[model samples]
Target: MPFPIKVCAVCSEEFELKPDKPGFANRCPECSIPESTGDSSTKQRMDADERKNASEANAARRQAMRELLYRKDS
Candidate 1:
């Protein structure tokens, strides 16, 4: 099947919207190229840390719920 045609949000050009296209659905491939800032690595590190902390918190919450549900009261 042919890919759907879409108008680029940035350049206002028509382009094929393919499944493997990067970035946003509304943006064309050329316009979808991510602009790199010098702090990208730092940002990635921060994001990883945030994900780790969130995972830990979620695990703690699940453990608490399990204990509460499975506890025996006499």
Candidate 2:
């Protein structure tokens, strides 16, 4: 039997689907390869670290302002 035609989600190209294969792909072969090359976990971790650093900096700035306002001029 001939394979049925399916459209790729990423490239919007049509491809033949293999019925015998266990894993079926939503995107065509060309578009799917690039998607897997990047490490998502590393990217997420970097983003989280950046946010944490920004929060700490803001807190330190506010503390300095409070100390300046409370100090008595000699």
Candidate 3:
């Protein structure tokens, strides 16, 4: 029998469950599969670093804009 269709929690994509599988999955097949890196920990670390870098860049831009507006007031 075919498994019922379900929504993935991570990607919010619709997918069908595998009837041959024994357990339930919260994420879609794409999201469920980890990055094909030699080391999962390294991949996770790189992702974290990217997030941090992007966050820092955004904060810097906001600060620069605030300074520019302040200069206009002066």
TM-scores for all candidates: the values are 0.49, 0.39, 0.42
When summed lDDT is taken over every stretch of 10 residues in candidate 2, the lowest stretch is 19-28
Stretches of model 3 off by over 4 angstroms after superposition? 20-24, 40-74
Worst 10 residues of 1 by lDDT: 37-46
How many clashes show up in model 2?
Answer: 0
**CA displacement after TM-score superposition, residue 26 of candidate 3 (Å):** 1.4
Better of 2 and 3 by TM-score: 3
Give the candidates in order of lDDT, highest first: 1, 3, 2
Model 2, C-alpha of 71: deviation from truth (Å): 49
Candidate 1, 1-74: lDDT as tens digits: 99999999999999999888889999988888878746556554548888899999999999999999999998
Off by over 4 Å in 2: 19-24, 34-41, 44-74
In model 1, which residue pairs have backbone atoms overlapping below 3 Å?
Answer: none
RMSD of each: 5.7, 11.0, 9.1
Summarize candidate 3's per-residue lDDT along 1-74 as a digit string, tens digits.
Answer: 78888898877899988755433476677776656546755544548889999999999999999998787643
Scored by lDDT, model 2 comes in at 0.75
Candidate 1 vs candidate 2: which has greater lDDT? 1
